[model samples]
Target: MSTSRKKSRKARASRESSKPSKRTIYTAIALVSACAVTAVAIGLSTGDSDDGGKDATAATGAQPSLPGALGADGKGAKGKNGKPKKTEEPWDGKVKVLGDGSTSYTGPQPNQPKAEKLKPGQQPPQFIVFSWDGALQGDDRLFSHFRQVARDSNAQMTFFLSGMYLLPKSKRELYRPPQHKPGSAAISFATDPHIRDTLEQLRGAWQDGHEIGSHFNGHFCGAKGGDDWSTEEWKSEIKQQYSFVQNWKTNTGYTDIDPLPFDYTKELVGGRAPCLEGQKTLIPAAKSFGWRYDASSPGDFQLWPSKIDDVWNFPLQLLPYPKSEKQVLSMDFNFLYNQSGDSTEGDPAKYDEWLKLTRGGYLNGFERVYNGSRAPMFIGNHFENWNGGIYMQAIEDTMREACPREGVRCVSFRQLADWLDAQDPAVLAKLRGLDPAQAPDWKTFLK
Candidate 1:
């Protein structure tokens, strides 16, 4: 990049970290000072697939092979000499191709609600964003399940697509993950069938109004992972990720699958890195690419977000742990890791208690924002059935309990971005004054 652009990014980052405000915006901004409300947002918002319960998967062609139980260990099938491999049946007879036959722009993002300024003195709605990483539809089938859950609860969520999930194992060699050898990936390559199933889900989710962000490829974590990669390496990894998604048809020679809805180039905004590492380098790329947000940061306090290089720094927040006086990151893995160390199968006796604790952490996090700062709750999870799907239940319970309450809108990160953009800067400045625990008297403070 250019030196001038680098200087500008540094300036933007400086502005993001140092905000000029009296008290905490979370506290003072809560009042919204009647003057801040310019216009009221009207109408019920639309989400991914709002066609009155349309079955987006009722397609005539493209059948995915039966999915199997696979781990993210990169031990799936491979081609001879590590080159792009093939399947017995590349694609079915029916095929719908789009730009370069890579991805087709189906239509406008389904049900994307237009953001409008808040009415004077109207308290901002409590925004909660639930997201998943390494969006692979494995034997668990949680991807489709959560889609139903979100639909039932009238919420929209984000699914960060792991590029390797779509890349057929036969063509695994095509991926050159940063800091890793060619054809090598930290996450297991999906069998052709898993990729097919994931594609189907991706189509349905995008059509249903959910957002798809890049999880990059190869769940490389720990040493020599994203944390160890440089900005240039990150750029290469990102480019390869998009390539894997767009060129899946050619890689696997698959036909008959309808193109995914929405152009990915336009749809993708930002993502969390593997293990929440490598963001210092990643943010520069995000800024240059004009990504709206980056969620790779770890353990943030529950507060309204600010930009990093003019891009939203949507970090995973720290949540109160009922079991301990300490706090935990608001992610399922963190809770589980704390509860059972690294073991997926912890003592069955503590199952209920662990689940309750996870649920409590999420609720506590939400409550901290809803009743206090009104910061958007960011919860991340995987599709794994760790601890007998307790995390899933906890999240579902949180959604059910928290979403139906007054002034709550469980939404995608994209929606949160729009809402943040709609707010008046002065009002936002005041809102930023609030510490997560600090709540000011609305009537008196706004006046």
Candidate 2:
């Protein structure tokens, strides 16, 4: 590491030490079980609520600022005063329906930018991956809403689809989650209509260049949750995720609906474990299925990513809580937990304030990496409308403000891994060595 990097680390530690200890990061995760009921009772449950709203996949450190504004005409950043950007190209190949006709093989995914090796001394683009867990399209229509948001912001996100969402409740017994009864699940199974809507969103999301990764089946957490699962059990879970997605047609018995526009087995490259637990075994289980990345880590600082057991470990980062010396995890549940304790329905009066803080926290993280180390920002969220849907609003606003900025690429985990793989190992090593806020001399750094 360079002198600047050393100073940056020291400054970060000092700032952290100065803050009054409120809640420990692990404590934040442990508190999820208490709040799970609120998310579920609201009927917006994505099946991960029982595990604290699906993958807090987060940790604490640093902060971010400045909200952005954009329109939703589907023109992306290029049509406005914002920076010029690329848009998705239409797929030209004929679709070949795959097994059981639940999914099909469209050619290569559209709107994907080719991952090119960075030139020596060239500055890295700030990368932001906005990933969703339990990607179910309930009555809220959030799944479709964010898809439009991505198109308007020149962004492509990762939707971590829960396998149970594709498996109708009537066919629930077919799902054999390890350690749990064959038909039992922590959260509610998707209603048939919701499942149909979710399937539509999944089809369109992939066609629009978004990545469809797994959030695994049956959002189990804590005790018998992912945290306690053995490697073999995790492998069983992984296989079932594939099984549910690939055989949704068989399970749903919907003859009128078209097959999903991509082969899930081939398209799946990574996943975030429910409640961000069980990653120790999850990593090996994921790797066995040729996964390229895993976003199941509980927490880490906002830094450049590194591989764990050769699989890209994309942990949710901690960001500075706005206007405070303290930091919060980058996921919505952490923000919700901090603001209202275990209750999802906090002070309605403070909704505006909470939303402001949440947006600021994300922007603070974004601003830090965008202006500093250019480390990739990985933000995890669900589609629930907790706390009057403030978290959802905050994320949408952040996307508009950040995605269209110069030298920023709002992409998916698979895309990030692709870009990382395209770089020289030494270059990546040097990049990862710098502090999150340390902007080094690029020429010498790469040289």
Candidate 3:
């Protein structure tokens, strides 16, 4: 052998001699066995039969056999007749659905004896007003609740919404994941993935024959950290709002299904001021936007052309708050607490009071309007408040009491507009002539 080869072989033998021997291998195997035994004992002590079975399977590669019954085709399993069982139908979970039908706006006139009594085929002056404000806050439970209330009352309500809430932001961050609140469950209402889910819900309401109106962009203002924008700012915001709705329509192919009847032209029509802050500036700005009617005012319920333009102002007659002294006191406290951000302690009593007051106010307002023969009552409520089970029940109860009564017709803004459009030119002209500031009372009109 060469000297170099002998030197290399000696070096290799020395390295091999330095390596650990069978003792180390035995030690590792013993440690692994101890761990497996410990795990099995612990699992058994914990009463985990499955763990024991798994361990046994791992050790032996053996599993308990299933039933040996053969199918008609001699398959592994069989049905009652001994034939191979077919796969079961998918477990379609329960799904909620709404009804389909158009709600009427005009009811049969009150009396028929006198010559001045509404002539046959001559419909009474009916006004339809839609208000959209404060919809779908934290989970759409409120929105859903409001829909149910409206359904029960057979009242077709319109909703106007700002697209800002529909946007993804910290406002909606808490709803992102894991929490699974009502509004968060659907990706359609998400900020980045802004789908037409909200719109579709509204459109479904529309398809079922309800009104869908715009609440304006960034109009959430109030105790909730909402935008405190001016009239000009609001106008700019509404432009964005309009664009968002348009985008949703385009993306969802809703434009193909049913294009919005009113465009920017033809007085794109009804709107409710953000925060009910319908100042003088809003009226003029609304006119400039070619809006034919606005529902934020607290004046008479009648509709007339805007003071600035030909638009109409259908003032909101009632909010879902009670008229009792206790209710008022509670509301005042809640308002203060909410404003101060100290409402961490929710008051169900206060909420109930507010509900009672709201329901009472609605009932009173309805009576006032119907009894006086003024325009239809333009009632308003937030999706947030209306969604409360108690509040929703109160609303349903009040509407049930009022909607079926004489001279009371629950209608939406679109239906009101359509009815107005179909009215006699002279009546419309007379309505136009009547000063909105001091219109004839319902009593006078009815008399």
Candidate 4:
């Protein structure tokens, strides 16, 4: 990281600590129904919590090999050493600019893995998706940093970009969020420099083979949020999300930057809702647009994904919270809510311990599926440096440790969906049936 970037991170952290608002609250409103099994309570929203508890896990030693797990090249019958081989770019076509030069069609995306069906008696690769919400390139430069992180780790990720991040604060009234005043929003609009930086990051991210999805606009939660909106209201919100991104060149009146490399309508295939709420209506609205998946559901076990109404329901998962029987949602906010209770800046003396516990919890989840069922792991995060930047460190460490392991493929949600679509449905059903710790005899199981 550069000196200027380090200073920016410290300045952002200071600002967040001094002026906490509804957007920075990180509150847990109510636990998801699935968490009832483990007697754990947590919610997804912006608020406060008073319960500060710590938990750790015993290491599940010795990874049991999947008998016939495929290697990185996607053709070999078993695992191999070193980094997974990335596929070459599939298209070399002419760019076609569209709609006032805000976006263009640049042919098929590059460096994506080929979605091949599992051979008979072969085990599937271990997949882990590291996604970011509210993808903004603030003064902290986190968006740009993580792009380099992904390149180093040989991973492709999903960045749910907030549409309003592109619309300047000067033109705030251009947005009319449902059930709120024309310009009102739960989150702050990006500054002019931040908007420009975010645009550059989005452009590079897509070109680098990362999926640029939506975080919607305005980011309303709790009352009058996605929860309260009807299907039609959800439709209106979705429409505005597209409008803001598609018309950013007009909205910002900037001419020097190149148009985004891919068309928004075709590139955008999914999104995660604010607070992981409103999937009930959001799904229907999304389906109308032919979206392939939705990642807004709050909690589920670390198992293979299944469809809801023919749309891939990619929910945030529940991972083992170390040193306890309870499970926490696989998101940075949940970890912060549990360890420090509503405070982004917790006790300084405990920062190292908290970082260990956070990193351990994710690793525990990874080891379970890695050695046993081989289900995909979904880890979500934000760019904000909460708890002295421990969570950001935890994620980066996890990616470096996990992505290069044999038979492990760190992919974007879109790539995961494509792989799932190519598999035999009955085989997927069988794989989904295995417990998170149940390593099966692949030769017999798939046969």
List RMSD in Å for every model shown: 15.7, 12.5, 31.2, 14.4
Name the 10 consecutive residues with the lowest summed lDDT in model 4.
11-20
Q: In model 1, what is the error at residue 65, expressed in angstroms? A: 28
Give candidate 1's TM-score. 0.77
Model 3 segments more than 4 A misplaced: 1-130, 137-140, 165-196, 220-234, 249-268, 298-308, 318-346, 349-354, 385-389, 421-447
Candidate models: Cα lDDT each: 0.67, 0.73, 0.38, 0.74
Sorting all predicted structures by TM-score, with the top scorer first, yields 4, 2, 1, 3
Steric clashes per prediction: 21, 8, 20, 6
What does candidate 4 score in Cα RMSD to the true structure? 14.4
Task: Give one digit per residue, the lDDT tens place, for model 3 in 1-447.
Answer: 234323322221000000110111111010112111100000000111011111010101111111222222223243455433222333344321211111111212121112233333333543333344534434445555656666676566667655444444423322212112211211123343333345435545654556556655433222220123345544543454444443333223333333332222222356765434544556555544445466654332233433334445564331212323211111111222222222323465566665565457555545544443344555454443321344345556766777655555567765665555555555555554442233464444422
User: Per-residue alpha-carbon lDDT of model 1 for 153-226, expressed as tens digits?
Assistant: 88899998888788776676676666555666555678888989999999899888899997887665555766
Best TM-score among the predictions, by candidate number: 4
Score residue 424 of candidate 3 by CA lDDT.
54
Clashing pairs in 2: 62-319, 62-320, 63-320, 63-364, 64-364, 64-365, 65-363, 65-364
Candidate 4: stretches off by over 4 Å: 1-26, 29-92
Candidate 3: count the clashes.
20
- Candidates 1 and 4 compared by TM-score, better number: 4
Pitting candidate 1 against candidate 3, the one with the higher TM-score is 1
Cα error, residue 141 of model 1, in Å, equals: 0.7
